[model samples]
Target chain A: EPEVTQTPSHQVTQMGQEVILRCVPISNHLYFYWYRQILGQKVEFLVSFYNNEISEKSEIFDDQFSVERPDGSNFTLKIRSTKLEDSAMYFCASSRRTGSPLHFGNGTRLTVT
Target chain B: AQTVTQSQPEMSVQEAETVTLSCTYDTSESDYYLFWYKQPPSRQMILVIRQEAYKQQNATENRFSVNFQKAAKSFSLKISDSQLGDAAMYFCALSTGANSKLTFGKGITLSVRP
Candidate 1:
């Protein structure tokens, strides 16, 4: 079974530094999403992309956050300036289409120091 | 806005026994989907089961089953013949039609004793 893959399972960066989280969604999937889980908190939606544009986003996805499908295969989330609160497990997910169950990646643990 | 709630923070069950994790959700949309995801110590999120709001029958997959009460807005996961491997953090999530962005609950940690 094809699954979503994320690189740099663990990332540690300075508070003011820029960081990019990479994800390779399932080859055949059309919808891509990013979610984050702060320790002891519920998983929160960050953004969703389809047809090469952002479809929906949450408040947590602010000016510092941006997502792009740089190529046909890789989806990347870039944070311009990291903050302590940005530390969490970031998950990448993909679905065949809307209403389909999303398949998630193992997640990238981002630690903002 | 949709919200999923997992009231029990943790639960314990002996091997071969049964355990149920409760979840309730509030959603104004009549058309939506519910899902249970399991995260073991490795922290990999695994899909356990899914329930469609329009379906009257509950969803089941082998030892995993759901008691879905649409009227009560409740969706609970029942694990039968539990094994130590079943120990994990289970999350209840919801997504509305045409919008696959999932809204998840805090999650419940299940511990299966041998």
Candidate 2:
């Protein structure tokens, strides 16, 4: 089965440094999303993208966070300046349509020092 | 806004026994979707089952089944003949309206004793 793939299974960065988490969603999926989970916490939605634009975002997805599908295949999330609280497991997900069940990747563990 | 709640933080069941993880959500939209996701120690989140609000019959897959009460806004996952591998963190999620974003519960940790 085709599944979403994320790069840098684990990322370690220092505060004030910029970080980028990359993902390659299923080729045919049109809707993409980014979610995060703190240690032993529930998953929280970050943002959703469709039709080459952001459809919706959560309060946590503030100015420091940005997502881009630079190429047609690779989707990336960039953090302008990392903070200790930015440490978490970031998940990339995609679906064929709005109502379809999302397929998630193994997730990228981001750690800020 | 929609919120999902998993009241039981932890639960345990004997191998070959049965266990149910409770989930409740508050949503104003009549048309929405509910899902149960399992995350093992490997930390890979996998979809277990999904149910549409319009469906009256519960959704089932193999030994995994759901008890969905739309009126009560409850969706629970029932794992029958559970095995040791069934032990994991289970999350309840909701997606409403045209958005593909998912709102997830705090998650329930299930431990299966040998």
Candidate 3:
């Protein structure tokens, strides 16, 4: 089965530096999303994209955060200035349509120093 | 706001025994979906089962089943004949039709004894 794949399973970035987390959502899936889980915490939604634009976003998705499809397959989340609090495991997910269950990637562990 | 709650932080069951993990959610929207996701030590999130709010019958997949009480806003997962592979952090999540973003509860760690 096709699965969402994320690059650089582990990323370590200096504070105040820009970092882009890349993901290749499952082919043929229409909806894409980004979620993050801090250690020992619940997973939190960051953003959701559809039709090449953001459909919805959480308060955690601030001005410093941005998402782009960039291409037909690549969905990337860019943090302009990383903060130490940004450290977490980021998961990329995709679904065939609205109301469909999302399939998640193996997640990228980001550590901001 | 939609919130999912997993009261139990951890649970353990002997191999071949049964285990149930409890989850409760508060949502104003009538149309929503509940899901169970398992994250093993590898930390890969895997979908275990899903229950649609509109469905009266509980959702079941092989040894995994859900006891969904829409009125009580409760959804629980039951793993029958548990195996070592069932050891993982199980998360209960909720998503509404208006918003597809999932709100997950603090996951419960499940351990299986041989």
Top-TM-score structure, candidate number: 2
Highest DockQ: which candidate? Answer: 2
Please give the CA lDDT of all the candidate structures. 0.94, 0.95, 0.93
Q: lDDT tens digits, residues B1-114, model 2?
A: 899999999999999998999999999888899999999998999999999989999999999999999999999999999999999999999988676679999999999999
TM-score of 2: 0.99
List DockQ for all candidates: 0.78, 0.84, 0.74
Q: Candidate 3 clashing pairs?
A: none
lDDT of 3 by residue, B1-114 (tens): 889999999999999999999999999998888999999988899999988899999999999999999999999999999999999999999988644778899999999999
Interface RMSD of each: 1.1, 0.8, 1.3
Clashing residue pairs in candidate 1 are: none
What 10-residue stretch in candidate 1 chain A is worst by lDDT? A93-102
Error of 2 at A88 (Å): 0.3
Say which prediction, candidate 1 or candidate 2, comes out ahead on TM-score. 2
Stretches off by above 4 angstroms in model 3 are none
Q: Per-residue lDDT for A2-113 in model 1, tens only?
A: 9999998999999999999999999999999999999777788999999999999999999999999998999999999999999999999999976688899999999999
Off by over 4 Å in 2: none
Q: What is the TM-score of chain B alone in each candidate?
A: 0.98, 0.98, 0.98
Candidate 2 CAPRI grade: high
Model 1 DockQ, alpha carbons vs. true complex: 0.78
**Tens digit of per-residue lDDT, candidate 3, span A1-113:** 89999998999999999999999998998889999999878899999998999999989999999999997989999999999999999999998876778899999999999
User: Tens digits of per-residue lDDT for model 1 on B2-103?
Assistant: 889999999999999999999999999988999999999888889999898889999999999999999999999999999999999999999885758899
Model 2, C-alpha of B80: deviation from truth (Å)? 0.3
